[model samples]
Target: MADTPNSPVVDAQLRRASVQERLGALEVEQARLRQELVSLSGELRLPGLYLTLDAAGTSALLVADAVQEVVRLVELEPLPGAPPHVAGTFIYRGSPAVAVDLAVLLGVTREPALDAHLVICKGARPVAVLVDRVRDLVEAPVLVEGTPDGDVALPWDGTGLMAGLCRTPEGIRPLLRISAVLVGSEET
Candidate 1:
Protein backbone atom coordinates (compact mmCIF):
# COMPACT_ATOMS: atom_id res chain seq x y z
CA MET A 1 0.00 0.00 0.00
CA ALA A 2 1.28 3.47 -0.89
CA ASP A 3 1.16 5.79 2.10
CA THR A 4 0.35 9.45 1.57
CA PRO A 5 2.49 12.15 3.25
CA ASN A 6 -0.42 13.10 5.47
CA SER A 7 -1.23 9.49 6.44
CA PRO A 8 -1.11 8.62 10.15
CA VAL A 9 1.73 6.08 9.68
CA VAL A 10 3.83 8.51 7.63
CA ASP A 11 3.26 11.32 10.15
CA ALA A 12 4.28 9.09 13.04
CA GLN A 13 7.47 8.01 11.31
CA LEU A 14 8.47 11.59 10.46
CA ARG A 15 7.85 12.77 14.00
CA ARG A 16 9.98 9.95 15.41
CA ALA A 17 12.87 10.81 13.10
CA SER A 18 12.71 14.49 14.03
CA VAL A 19 12.66 13.73 17.72
CA GLN A 20 15.68 11.42 17.40
CA GLU A 21 17.66 14.08 15.54
CA ARG A 22 16.85 16.66 18.22
CA LEU A 23 17.96 14.28 20.92
CA GLY A 24 21.26 13.69 19.15
CA ALA A 25 21.92 17.40 18.91
CA LEU A 26 21.12 17.86 22.58
CA GLU A 27 23.52 15.10 23.56
CA VAL A 28 26.33 16.74 21.61
CA GLU A 29 25.61 20.08 23.24
CA GLN A 30 25.66 18.49 26.68
CA ALA A 31 29.08 16.95 26.04
CA ARG A 32 30.49 20.26 24.87
CA LEU A 33 29.19 22.02 27.97
CA ARG A 34 30.67 19.36 30.21
CA GLN A 35 34.09 19.86 28.62
CA GLU A 36 33.84 23.60 29.10
CA LEU A 37 32.97 23.16 32.78
CA VAL A 38 35.96 20.90 33.30
CA SER A 39 38.30 23.44 31.73
CA LEU A 40 36.88 26.30 33.77
CA SER A 41 37.06 24.43 37.04
CA GLY A 42 40.73 23.72 36.42
CA GLU A 43 41.40 27.35 35.70
CA LEU A 44 39.54 28.49 38.80
CA ARG A 45 41.61 26.29 41.10
CA LEU A 46 44.13 28.22 43.28
CA PRO A 47 47.45 26.41 43.18
CA GLY A 48 49.22 26.59 46.55
CA LEU A 49 48.79 26.02 50.24
CA TYR A 50 46.35 28.15 52.26
CA LEU A 51 46.37 28.78 55.96
CA THR A 52 42.87 28.43 57.33
CA LEU A 53 41.93 30.13 60.58
CA ASP A 54 38.94 30.66 62.80
CA ALA A 55 38.10 34.35 62.60
CA ALA A 56 35.65 34.71 65.45
CA GLY A 57 33.04 32.16 64.39
CA THR A 58 33.75 32.61 60.69
CA SER A 59 36.24 30.56 58.72
CA ALA A 60 38.88 32.36 56.72
CA LEU A 61 41.92 31.63 54.59
CA LEU A 62 45.19 33.33 53.74
CA VAL A 63 47.52 32.35 50.95
CA ALA A 64 50.54 30.53 52.31
CA ASP A 65 52.90 32.52 50.11
CA ALA A 66 52.07 35.68 52.04
CA VAL A 67 52.27 34.02 55.46
CA GLN A 68 55.61 34.34 57.23
CA GLU A 69 54.90 32.26 60.34
CA VAL A 70 52.37 31.46 63.07
CA VAL A 71 53.31 32.38 66.60
CA ARG A 72 51.77 31.75 69.99
CA LEU A 73 49.86 34.45 71.85
CA VAL A 74 52.32 37.24 72.59
CA GLU A 75 52.06 40.36 74.69
CA LEU A 76 51.13 43.30 72.46
CA GLU A 77 51.92 46.89 73.34
CA PRO A 78 48.68 48.82 72.95
CA LEU A 79 48.73 51.35 70.12
CA PRO A 80 47.15 54.29 71.87
CA GLY A 81 44.65 56.28 69.77
CA ALA A 82 44.62 53.52 67.16
CA PRO A 83 41.38 52.10 65.85
CA PRO A 84 39.73 49.27 67.76
CA HIS A 85 40.61 46.90 64.92
CA VAL A 86 44.24 47.58 65.68
CA ALA A 87 44.81 45.22 68.63
CA GLY A 88 48.29 46.55 69.36
CA THR A 89 51.93 46.34 68.22
CA PHE A 90 54.33 43.47 68.73
CA ILE A 91 58.03 42.88 68.26
CA TYR A 92 58.79 40.40 65.49
CA ARG A 93 62.39 39.46 64.74
CA GLY A 94 63.51 42.66 66.53
CA SER A 95 61.17 44.84 64.38
CA PRO A 96 57.72 46.19 65.20
CA ALA A 97 54.71 44.54 63.56
CA VAL A 98 51.18 45.83 63.95
CA ALA A 99 48.58 43.34 65.18
CA VAL A 100 45.20 43.62 63.52
CA ASP A 101 42.37 41.94 65.36
CA LEU A 102 40.58 39.74 62.85
CA ALA A 103 37.42 39.56 64.91
CA VAL A 104 37.16 43.32 65.26
CA LEU A 105 38.00 43.84 61.61
CA LEU A 106 35.17 41.50 60.64
CA GLY A 107 32.80 43.38 62.95
CA VAL A 108 32.68 40.61 65.54
CA THR A 109 32.73 41.85 69.14
CA ARG A 110 34.20 38.88 70.95
CA GLU A 111 37.43 39.07 72.87
CA PRO A 112 40.22 36.79 71.69
CA ALA A 113 40.96 33.80 73.91
CA LEU A 114 44.14 33.57 75.93
CA ASP A 115 45.32 30.76 73.62
CA ALA A 116 44.83 32.75 70.42
CA HIS A 117 47.57 32.65 67.81
CA LEU A 118 48.88 35.31 65.48
CA VAL A 119 49.26 34.75 61.76
CA ILE A 120 52.18 36.87 60.56
CA CYS A 121 51.48 38.00 57.02
CA LYS A 122 53.81 39.96 54.71
CA GLY A 123 52.14 42.51 52.54
CA ALA A 124 53.14 46.15 51.89
CA ARG A 125 54.42 45.67 55.44
CA PRO A 126 54.38 42.89 57.98
CA VAL A 127 51.21 42.58 60.06
CA ALA A 128 50.03 40.02 62.55
CA VAL A 129 46.40 38.98 62.30
CA LEU A 130 44.82 37.90 65.57
CA VAL A 131 42.69 34.81 65.09
CA ASP A 132 40.75 32.77 67.58
CA ARG A 133 42.65 29.71 66.49
CA VAL A 134 44.64 28.38 63.57
CA ARG A 135 42.73 25.73 61.64
CA ASP A 136 44.98 24.00 59.13
CA LEU A 137 46.87 24.30 55.86
CA VAL A 138 44.83 23.19 52.89
CA GLU A 139 44.89 23.19 49.11
CA ALA A 140 41.58 24.52 47.85
CA PRO A 141 39.97 26.44 45.01
CA VAL A 142 39.55 30.15 45.63
CA LEU A 143 37.00 32.02 43.54
CA VAL A 144 38.36 35.54 43.50
CA GLU A 145 35.79 37.31 41.37
CA GLY A 146 32.68 35.18 41.20
CA THR A 147 30.56 33.10 43.52
CA PRO A 148 30.52 29.38 43.12
CA ASP A 149 27.37 27.95 41.43
CA GLY A 150 26.19 31.50 40.64
CA ASP A 151 23.49 31.48 43.33
CA VAL A 152 25.38 30.65 46.51
CA ALA A 153 25.85 33.81 48.53
CA LEU A 154 29.14 34.12 50.38
CA PRO A 155 29.34 35.23 54.00
CA TRP A 156 31.08 38.49 53.24
CA ASP A 157 30.49 41.86 54.87
CA GLY A 158 30.91 43.71 51.52
CA THR A 159 34.33 44.76 52.74
CA GLY A 160 37.06 44.78 50.10
CA LEU A 161 39.31 42.96 52.55
CA MET A 162 38.29 39.58 51.18
CA ALA A 163 39.97 38.68 47.93
CA GLY A 164 37.81 35.61 47.37
CA LEU A 165 36.05 32.63 48.89
CA CYS A 166 37.80 29.31 49.25
CA ARG A 167 35.96 25.98 49.15
CA THR A 168 37.13 23.58 51.82
CA PRO A 169 35.86 20.35 53.31
CA GLU A 170 34.84 22.35 56.36
CA GLY A 171 32.85 24.76 54.16
CA ILE A 172 33.38 27.98 52.23
CA ARG A 173 36.00 30.23 53.80
CA PRO A 174 36.65 33.83 52.87
CA LEU A 175 40.17 34.45 51.55
CA LEU A 176 41.56 37.54 53.25
CA ARG A 177 43.29 40.05 50.99
CA ILE A 178 46.49 40.90 52.83
CA SER A 179 47.25 43.97 50.74
CA ALA A 180 43.82 45.43 51.31
CA VAL A 181 44.11 44.80 55.04
CA LEU A 182 47.52 46.43 55.08
CA VAL A 183 46.22 49.46 53.21
CA GLY A 184 43.21 49.80 55.47
CA SER A 185 45.37 49.60 58.56
CA GLU A 186 47.66 52.27 57.16
CA GLU A 187 44.74 54.57 56.50
CA THR A 188 43.68 54.30 60.11
Candidate 2:
Protein backbone atom coordinates (compact mmCIF):
# COMPACT_ATOMS: atom_id res chain seq x y z
CA MET A 1 0.00 0.00 0.00
CA ALA A 2 1.39 3.39 -1.08
CA ASP A 3 0.90 6.32 1.24
CA THR A 4 -1.19 9.16 -0.24
CA PRO A 5 -2.88 12.27 1.19
CA ASN A 6 -6.36 10.81 0.37
CA SER A 7 -5.59 7.39 1.94
CA PRO A 8 -6.53 6.94 5.61
CA VAL A 9 -3.74 5.41 7.73
CA VAL A 10 -5.50 4.29 10.97
CA ASP A 11 -7.71 1.17 11.29
CA ALA A 12 -11.14 2.72 12.14
CA GLN A 13 -12.69 -0.68 12.94
CA LEU A 14 -10.07 -1.39 15.61
CA ARG A 15 -10.59 2.03 17.15
CA ARG A 16 -14.35 1.50 17.31
CA ALA A 17 -13.88 -1.93 18.89
CA SER A 18 -11.66 -0.39 21.58
CA VAL A 19 -14.36 2.15 22.48
CA GLN A 20 -17.03 -0.58 22.64
CA GLU A 21 -14.85 -2.66 24.97
CA ARG A 22 -14.52 0.32 27.32
CA LEU A 23 -18.30 0.88 27.30
CA GLY A 24 -18.99 -2.76 28.19
CA ALA A 25 -16.52 -2.54 31.07
CA LEU A 26 -18.26 0.58 32.36
CA GLU A 27 -21.68 -1.14 32.28
CA VAL A 28 -20.37 -4.08 34.33
CA GLU A 29 -18.90 -1.67 36.87
CA GLN A 30 -22.24 0.15 37.12
CA ALA A 31 -24.09 -3.11 37.84
CA ARG A 32 -21.60 -4.02 40.58
CA LEU A 33 -22.03 -0.64 42.27
CA ARG A 34 -25.81 -1.07 42.22
CA GLN A 35 -25.53 -4.48 43.93
CA GLU A 36 -23.27 -2.98 46.60
CA LEU A 37 -25.82 -0.26 47.28
CA VAL A 38 -28.61 -2.83 47.75
CA SER A 39 -26.35 -4.85 50.08
CA LEU A 40 -25.63 -1.74 52.12
CA SER A 41 -29.34 -1.10 52.59
CA GLY A 42 -29.81 -4.63 53.86
CA GLU A 43 -26.93 -4.22 56.32
CA LEU A 44 -28.54 -1.05 57.64
CA ARG A 45 -31.92 -2.80 57.91
CA LEU A 46 -33.53 0.24 56.32
CA PRO A 47 -37.31 0.54 56.36
CA GLY A 48 -39.46 0.27 53.23
CA LEU A 49 -43.05 1.05 52.36
CA TYR A 50 -45.59 -1.78 52.74
CA LEU A 51 -49.28 -1.42 51.84
CA THR A 52 -52.46 -2.81 53.40
CA LEU A 53 -54.66 -3.40 50.34
CA ASP A 54 -57.65 -5.05 51.96
CA ALA A 55 -59.34 -5.74 55.27
CA ALA A 56 -58.30 -9.40 54.89
CA GLY A 57 -54.75 -8.09 55.43
CA THR A 58 -53.60 -8.90 51.91
CA SER A 59 -50.71 -6.45 51.68
CA ALA A 60 -48.19 -5.90 48.90
CA LEU A 61 -45.13 -3.90 47.86
CA LEU A 62 -42.52 -3.54 45.12
CA VAL A 63 -38.78 -3.24 45.49
CA ALA A 64 -37.86 0.36 46.28
CA ASP A 65 -36.25 0.65 42.86
CA ALA A 66 -39.45 -0.58 41.15
CA VAL A 67 -41.66 2.06 42.69
CA GLN A 68 -41.93 5.42 41.00
CA GLU A 69 -44.32 7.27 43.34
CA VAL A 70 -47.57 7.20 45.28
CA VAL A 71 -50.13 9.73 44.19
CA ARG A 72 -53.58 10.79 45.35
CA LEU A 73 -56.49 8.96 43.72
CA VAL A 74 -58.29 10.97 41.11
CA GLU A 75 -61.18 10.32 38.74
CA LEU A 76 -60.24 7.63 36.26
CA GLU A 77 -61.84 7.18 32.83
CA PRO A 78 -63.34 3.73 32.60
CA LEU A 79 -61.90 1.38 30.02
CA PRO A 80 -65.02 -0.03 28.33
CA GLY A 81 -65.03 -3.82 27.89
CA ALA A 82 -61.96 -4.06 30.10
CA PRO A 83 -61.78 -6.39 33.07
CA PRO A 84 -63.37 -5.30 36.33
CA HIS A 85 -59.94 -4.97 37.85
CA VAL A 86 -59.20 -2.18 35.43
CA ALA A 87 -60.12 1.10 37.13
CA GLY A 88 -59.89 2.86 33.79
CA THR A 89 -57.23 5.21 32.46
CA PHE A 90 -55.49 8.18 34.02
CA ILE A 91 -53.05 10.68 32.66
CA TYR A 92 -49.67 10.01 34.21
CA ARG A 93 -47.10 12.70 33.52
CA GLY A 94 -48.97 13.58 30.31
CA SER A 95 -48.98 9.93 29.18
CA PRO A 96 -52.06 7.73 29.33
CA ALA A 97 -51.81 4.87 31.84
CA VAL A 98 -54.28 2.23 33.00
CA ALA A 99 -55.26 2.38 36.65
CA VAL A 100 -55.56 -1.07 38.25
CA ASP A 101 -57.11 -1.92 41.56
CA LEU A 102 -54.70 -4.51 42.88
CA ALA A 103 -57.40 -5.86 45.13
CA VAL A 104 -59.79 -6.30 42.24
CA LEU A 105 -57.09 -7.87 40.11
CA LEU A 106 -56.28 -10.24 42.91
CA GLY A 107 -59.99 -11.09 43.48
CA VAL A 108 -60.16 -9.48 46.90
CA THR A 109 -63.72 -8.57 47.93
CA ARG A 110 -63.22 -5.34 49.88
CA GLU A 111 -63.70 -2.03 48.10
CA PRO A 112 -61.10 0.70 48.21
CA ALA A 113 -61.78 3.65 50.46
CA LEU A 114 -62.61 7.15 49.23
CA ASP A 115 -59.08 8.19 50.14
CA ALA A 116 -57.29 5.32 48.44
CA HIS A 117 -54.13 6.27 46.56
CA LEU A 118 -52.44 5.07 43.39
CA VAL A 119 -49.02 3.48 43.29
CA ILE A 120 -47.00 4.37 40.20
CA CYS A 121 -44.88 1.33 39.32
CA LYS A 122 -41.60 1.62 37.42
CA GLY A 123 -40.50 -0.86 34.75
CA ALA A 124 -40.61 -1.40 30.96
CA ARG A 125 -44.09 0.14 31.10
CA PRO A 126 -45.44 2.06 34.08
CA VAL A 127 -48.80 1.00 35.58
CA ALA A 128 -50.92 2.27 38.46
CA VAL A 129 -51.63 0.03 41.49
CA LEU A 130 -54.58 1.37 43.45
CA VAL A 131 -54.36 0.59 47.14
CA ASP A 132 -56.44 1.62 50.14
CA ARG A 133 -53.65 3.71 51.62
CA VAL A 134 -49.91 4.12 51.50
CA ARG A 135 -48.05 3.42 54.68
CA ASP A 136 -44.67 4.84 55.52
CA LEU A 137 -41.67 2.61 54.83
CA VAL A 138 -40.80 0.03 57.50
CA GLU A 139 -37.50 -1.69 58.14
CA ALA A 140 -37.92 -5.17 56.61
CA PRO A 141 -35.46 -7.70 57.98
CA VAL A 142 -35.96 -11.26 56.76
CA LEU A 143 -37.69 -13.42 59.34
CA VAL A 144 -36.03 -16.67 60.27
CA GLU A 145 -39.05 -18.44 61.75
CA GLY A 146 -42.45 -16.78 61.91
CA THR A 147 -45.79 -17.66 60.31
CA PRO A 148 -46.70 -14.98 57.73
CA ASP A 149 -50.46 -14.44 57.84
CA GLY A 150 -51.35 -12.21 54.88
CA ASP A 151 -50.06 -14.09 51.87
CA VAL A 152 -52.51 -13.43 48.98
CA ALA A 153 -53.00 -16.21 46.47
CA LEU A 154 -52.30 -15.18 42.91
CA PRO A 155 -54.40 -16.18 39.90
CA TRP A 156 -51.65 -18.67 39.09
CA ASP A 157 -48.62 -20.05 40.90
CA GLY A 158 -45.17 -21.42 40.00
CA THR A 159 -44.38 -18.14 38.34
CA GLY A 160 -42.03 -16.10 40.55
CA LEU A 161 -44.96 -13.79 41.38
CA MET A 162 -44.99 -14.43 45.09
CA ALA A 163 -42.08 -13.04 47.13
CA GLY A 164 -43.36 -14.56 50.39
CA LEU A 165 -44.12 -12.61 53.57
CA CYS A 166 -41.73 -10.32 55.36
CA ARG A 167 -42.41 -10.19 59.11
CA THR A 168 -42.66 -6.56 60.22
CA PRO A 169 -43.33 -5.36 63.74
CA GLU A 170 -46.86 -4.44 62.70
CA GLY A 171 -47.48 -7.91 61.15
CA ILE A 172 -46.74 -9.99 58.07
CA ARG A 173 -46.74 -8.04 54.78
CA PRO A 174 -46.93 -9.63 51.34
CA LEU A 175 -44.27 -8.56 48.87
CA LEU A 176 -45.60 -7.71 45.39
CA ARG A 177 -43.92 -9.29 42.40
CA ILE A 178 -43.13 -6.29 40.20
CA SER A 179 -43.07 -8.33 37.02
CA ALA A 180 -46.37 -10.07 37.78
CA VAL A 181 -48.16 -6.90 38.85
CA LEU A 182 -46.84 -4.73 36.07
CA VAL A 183 -47.14 -7.39 33.36
CA GLY A 184 -49.50 -10.09 34.50
CA SER A 185 -48.56 -13.76 34.28
CA GLU A 186 -50.94 -14.12 31.33
CA GLU A 187 -49.04 -11.42 29.56
CA THR A 188 -45.72 -13.00 30.41
Give the best candidate by TM-score.
1
Per-residue CA lDDT of model 2 for 13-37, tens digit only, reads 4554465456445544643554465
Q: After superposition, how far is residue 93 of candidate 1 from its true place, in Å?
A: 1.5
Model 1: colliding residue pairs: none
Off by over 4 Å in 1: 1-43, 142-155
Q: Give me the runs in candidate 2 sitting further than 4 Å from their true place.
A: 1-57, 109-111, 143-161, 185-188
What shift in Å separates residue 36 of candidate 1 from its native position after superposition? 13
Tens digits of lDDT, candidate 1, 1-188: 89999999999868755664564455446434544654577445567899888876877888898888999879988988899889889899888889888888777877678999998886445688898999889885544334655777645547655655667777667777665555445544
RMSD of 1: 22.7
Backbone-clash count (model 2): 5
The TM-scores of all predictions, comma-separated, are 0.69, 0.60
